[model samples]
Every structure is written in structure tokens, then in C-alpha cells.
Target: MHPTLAYKWQCVFIQVGKFANEVFLLLPPYLPILAGSLSLELQVLNLAAAIVLIAGKAFWLKSGRITPTDFLATLDAYIGGGTANQVRVAILEAFKDGIGGIGTDEWKEAFTQLVLDNQMQTAEPLEDREHP
Candidate 1:
């Protein structure tokens, strides 16, 4: 992995770890105490549900798998306004090269330009289109 991407991944992992730690700290002993005092089975059940949900989400993130929709969205964000055929070919080439073929600075500039252009285009009046 490129140093920048590796750094980004590390930052994400750190954030996830902190979140999990905070969640775990809030549970367990507290649930037992609260459940015992209230004599409520529902509190225990809710705690169990929360644990399962958090565990499943953590497992999925650890698996390092990207969903198709996520991949498509990433591609669209990076390749906006490029010709479809060219985009397809570029994607293939990128996979073959095992590195991002575009320079990071260039990609950043293109993304910024695309966002600015989109904002301007959206702000244009519908009447302006007919005039052109």
C-alpha cells in the first residue's frame, strides 16, 4: 500500500478501535447491576442484542470487504465526467498495475474541479439552458 493510503487505513482502524472500546466500557458490569436492581429480563435481552449487533459490525469491518455499491460509488466519485469506455479501460489498467495509476495530487485536483463544476452547474437556472 502507498504510504498515504496505509496512513489513512491506520487512522480508520484507530477510530474503530476507540469506538469499540467506548462501547464495551459502557456495557457488561453496568447491565448486570441495572438488570439485577430492576429485576428486568428485558434489560439483559437488550444488552445481548446490542453486543451481537456490535460484534457483527466489527467482524464485517475486520474482513476488509467492500460492497459492490461502495465500489461503484468510489469509482463514480473518482471518475466523474470521464468517458464510460475510458473509465472502464482505466479501471482495468489500474487493477493490472496494482497501484493507483493517477497521481494523488492530480486525483485531488480533478475531484475538486468536478465538485466545483457540479455546484456551478446545479446552480444555473433552467432558463439558461434554453438560451444556450
Candidate 2:
């Protein structure tokens, strides 16, 4: 992704993380009263809160923008083989040119080809039969 767009997304993620943290903090004080009055189990509420907090934290970390190492790793994964180094250099250059990064065309094309190939592979075999 473009650095500017990545930066923007990072800021947005940070804001979301802050909001989630505030919500998580507010949940604890109400837990006792909610559990007692609503006849709900304390364990269930605690578990749900824990899951939300963990997911929120993970999102925050993942959306904090990609580093150079991350970019290189991702490029390698997407364009594997002997051309990986060349692909990485090209991708970095594209990003530096403010080109908004690589498009999703390659991924979409790969997915489409995979589907077509699978369909062709699984097609029924033809058989010759005499008709009366």
C-alpha cells in the first residue's frame, strides 16, 4: 500500500483501538451489577469481554502500518521464485513513486484461473454409446 494511505489507516486503527480500550475499561465496573441483576453467569461475560479485548488488540497491531521487513516478506510470498528480488525492487519503486502501490488485479486473476482450472479438472468425461 502507499505510505500515505498506510499512515492514514494506521491513524484510523489507533483511534479505533483507543475507543475499544475505553469500552473495555467501562465494562468491568458494570459486570458485577449486570451479572447480578440479569441472572447471567459471570464467567460468560468475562469470557466475552476477554475475547473482544484480544481481538481489538490484534487489529490494532496488524493495522499499525507495514514495515520495510513486512513489505519484503509479503512481496516474497506473493512473487516467489528467482524473480522475487526483482519483484521486491519493482514494488518498492512503485511505492516510492506515489503510485498507490500494487493493484489487486494479480490476486483476482489468480483466483479466477484457479476456479476455472478446478472446474475443468473436475469436468465429467465423455463416453460413446450406441442409441437404438
Candidate 3:
């Protein structure tokens, strides 16, 4: 379940991370210890890295005038063929370039949704949505 969307959808049993055998990376990212209790989840870390990878791919995908969605929909391969990896990569890439290249309209919309999800996790909407 998405964070801000949690208010709208409860009783969810979301793993909040990679579900498919394919992972964005072979190893988890390194993290520095923080003061107090501040910490970021491994899922979020993977997402950050994935966005960079997806953004680069989206740049090329759109240049070819092929939406990631369309490309992914046509994939016909088995697990050994890395089909799951393809879906994971293409979906994230598609999200970044649905309307424009990475960091454009689609990226903005997705970032907005992330903020909204964060707000849903709290009682009142966060006045400060910016990251520290």
C-alpha cells in the first residue's frame, strides 16, 4: 500500500518492497547511522536508485517514441529470460515518461503522489513536505 493512500485503502498486506524475484540491485545500499531514530527504509533506497536507472532508460524509450508501457505489454519471455526484471524496469521507466521525459510532467505527478502518500500516514497533512 502507498503511504498517503493508506487512509483510502486499509487492511493491506503490502511488503513495501520488491515482490518479484528480480531486484533492482544485488545488494542493499549502504547507510550511515543517524542521530535520534531517523532512518530510511531499504525499499525507498531501492526506489531512488531505480528512478535514476529508469530515468536514463525513459530518455531513450521516449526518443524512440515507444512508451515503456507499450514495450512492456509486448514482452513475451519466461523467468530465465528476465521478464520480471523487464517489467520492473519498464514500469518504473514508464512512470517517469508517461507524458514527457524524466523530470517532466509525469515525474512531477508521481512526486506529488508520493507527498500525498506521506500525508496519509499522518493524522494531519504535513505542512513541511520537503525532505530534511
Best by the lDDT measure: 1
List the candidate numbers ranked by TM-score, top first: 2, 1, 3
**Model 3 clash number:** 1
Model 2, position 88, has a per-residue lDDT of: 28
RMSD of 2: 24.2
Select the stronger candidate by TM-score from 1 and 2: 2
Error of 3 at 99 (Å): 31
Candidate 2 ranges with C-alpha deviation above 4 Å: 36-42, 45-132
Cα lDDT tens digits for candidate 2, 1-132: 999999999999998687656555544543442233222332343233333333333333347643333322322232222222332233333333333222477534533343332221111211222111
> For each candidate, what is the lDDT?
0.38, 0.37, 0.34
For model 1, residues 1-132, the per-residue Cα lDDT tens digits are: 899999999999987677656655544433443233322433433343334333433334436643333322322322232322232343333334332334577544543443333221111112211110
Model 1 spans > 4 angstroms off: 29-49, 52-132
Worst 10 residues of 1 by lDDT: 123-132
RMSD of each: 22.0, 24.2, 18.6
True lDDT of residue 127, candidate 2: 20
Q: Please give the lDDT score for candidate 2.
A: 0.37
